[model samples]
Target: MTEPQVRRVRLEEGFEVQAYIYGEGDETLFLANGGPGLPSLYLREPHARLARDGWRVVAWDQLGCGASDRPQDPALWALERYVAEAEQVRAALDLGPVHLLGHSWGTWLFTEYCLTHPEQVKSCILADGACDIPHLVGELDRLRSALGAETLAMMRRHEAEGSIDHPEYQAAITILNYRHVCRLQAWPDSLTAALADWNMGPYGEMQGPNEFTYTGNMKDWNRIPAMGAIAAPCLVLCGAHDELTPACSEKMHAALPNSWLKIFEASSHMPFHEEPEAYFPAVRAFLEEVAARAAVGGLTRKSHPCR
Candidate 1:
């Protein structure tokens, strides 16, 4: 299979965003990362597979992460701003009515974007994401408790004081990230490399001192009520062992009018990496069916409150 070509596009404010495009096909798939500020490089592998399957896949770093411009201003980290950025990216690439696949935090932004711009999306796939911030926090709490009181206390002390830069805090965060986030004892090279280049500037400012804490702008953010507004056919995926929990994903699936849920039995948060054999085939099949339906003028979306 041909390797993806890395490219750049200039947005409205002259901000340059980097994107990797692979394959040549009528169907365009945009992969959005979760960090709100995370770079899109972590999505490269999945996009590559999607491209190899006859779909054009575009994955880009968001404004504050990876190869994108990282402005020190915290205002650049808002949810709506990311939504606008996704829209601009789509328009810049001339990818109208595209299929959107959002992972983790990216799923939140994509859901908001889809709710606001239903007409611009043909389909959506939310992988290991949550519809409620409280639900996410609860999951974190459960994981912390499972780690035992002593570990939980240590994590709390650091997270409370914003001392995530401390080595102990880093160790704790690593444990949590590995356990529920990726489930791999050691993060994959692609993920590790991406993490190494992570612009913690924005993450510290927005996502709090670490992943468990939620003093950020997205703390109380819950899009559960807005799920019904999403008109596109959606595939909600969750890892059976994901920290986001299958319960949260199922809630989203139940609320969405045209949605389905799939649980990768042996995977954790990153199903694409953990269970690529199963994840790729499932995604490819869904996208193909969606494309076929659209070709027959069968996939139609309805306008809802958020739109």
Candidate 2:
């Protein structure tokens, strides 16, 4: 893979966002992380291979996450702000009609951006994303049951009492998050470091005490109706064992007019990390198909063509 060149751009609001760019391919791909607070560093390994395979991969830390300027005002961290940040990054990089990919919470921002500016997107990939928080809450409840009442009760009690700082509470939350989020036996160093640097202040104030609970503004949010309005070709990916589940993503695919669904058999929430071989190929194939269609329709430059 080529050496990654990191660039920092100042948004109109004076917030500096960092982006790591790799490769010189014509196809520019933007990857958005979940956590709303999770840095883009954890996505490095997954995207590095994409860069090696002839795609210009750009991963940026969203505001209040990673290396970006984390503002104190909670209002500045909303999904609308994030969508604007994404647009700013795209414009700053001059990456027009780019392929957009979002994981988990990032999918919310990506979906909103696509709906609001479909013309700017060439294609979209939503991986392990929860389109509706209510639906996600139901799925979390099912997983909680399988985890047994005792553990669930303990988790609830700790969260209710605002004891997230307690080591035991942290441990319990970590276990549950790992299982449903990444499904890795142990958290990888890159991911762990990113998590360590996460702006918990923002996460707590916005997303509540834990991942399962929804006390934030997005609690009752549902984008099912907006799915039909998306004009770009979309690929909705889910792992067989993902907490988001194939059924959830398939429902999104059904609602989208121009979309496809793919499930990775041996993966969970983080398919790019859990099943790189399948995940990368699937993404490349989808982008290629979109590029081919665009080429046929004379929508893009032939000189700087996509593979």
List, residue by residue over 1-307, the lDDT tens digit for candidate 1.
3567777878786788887788888889989987766667677765576776788888888887888776788777788877888898888888878999999888888999999899999999999998898888887788778878898898888767867678876787777778788876666777777877888766766566666777777888888987888878888899987878888898888889888788999898999889899898788878877887776764533421111
All-Cα superposition RMSD per candidate? 3.9, 3.9
Model 1, poorest ten-residue lDDT window?
298-307
lDDT of 2: 0.80
Collision count of model 1:
2
Candidate 1 has what TM-score?
0.92
In order, candidate lDDTs are 0.81, 0.80
Which candidate number would show the highest lDDT if scored against the true structure?
A: 1
Model 2 TM-score (2 dp): 0.91
lDDT of 2 by residue, 1-307 (tens): 3468888989988889888898889988888987878898877656777887788999898878777888888777678878888999999998887899998887888999999778888888898987877887888777766677887787778878987678876777676677767876876777778878888666666566667777877788899888999878788889888878677797788888778788989888888878888888788878777776776762222222221
